[model samples]
Target: MTLLTKLKKSNINRSEYLFLENKLAFLTTEVVENKYRNSKLVIGLLGFVSIGLVLVVLWMQRKRKGLPIVGLSRQERNIQGLILQGKSNKEIANELFISISTVKTHITNIYSKLHVSGREELLQKLQN
Candidate 1:
């Protein structure tokens, strides 16, 4: 009824039959391996594409908002916003639970990114 049954019933030499059986097993194993490899490749590509899409969407949204400090990290952006609201570095440090020096560091990074010399210039730049 099956291929193997027919082979067994046929008048084939033992060596030839054994060779054919081994070849069939080898082919089956190859097919399974190929399928596994293909699925892994597909999954990897999908993950890469999904990450790229998310980044693009975020960039588009940020651009649409016309945020002045586009290049600032989230922490730096928070510092800049607080500065705009007339909060001193010490207040920002207390509110954000960071050291005063850490707040100063974020402010410096924000100033460097926004090309502002000080809080006054930063305020002027963002207000316009």
Candidate 2:
């Protein structure tokens, strides 16, 4: 036998050795089970937090209802204001010191952003 086992055999009685061994085994099993349970709880909590954060971000990103003006840039907002005042594209171009094509492009971008096909539709949508 090894020196350690020979020492244990000399120092410890059979009943005492068996009781110590059983206690150690029980304690080790309890530790393993507790660790497993703790790790699972931590993982489950992290999963819920991750999903909750994703849901909050998605909720915040949703498009605002009733007022589409928030989506327009300053220049686009200016163009929209002029359009509301019954100005023609040429008039808007001259007033804004931009080319007529630039005005048309702005108007097109505004139309797309506002989801309108024409000036009348734009006015009607903005009214509601």
| Candidate whose TM-score is highest | 2
Top model number, lDDT: 1
- The TM-score that candidate 2 achieves is 0.68
- Each candidate's TM vs. the true structure? 0.49, 0.68
lDDT (CA) for every model shown?
0.88, 0.87
What's the TM for model 1? Answer: 0.49
Compared with the true structure, what per-residue lDDT tens digits does model 2 show for residues 36-58? Answer: 99999999999999999999887
Q: For residues 103-126, what per-residue lDDT tens digits would candidate 1 score against the true structure?
A: 999988987777778988888878
Model 2 misplaced regions, further than 4 Å:
1-10, 63-74, 94-97, 111-125
Candidate 1 regions off by >4 Å? 67-128
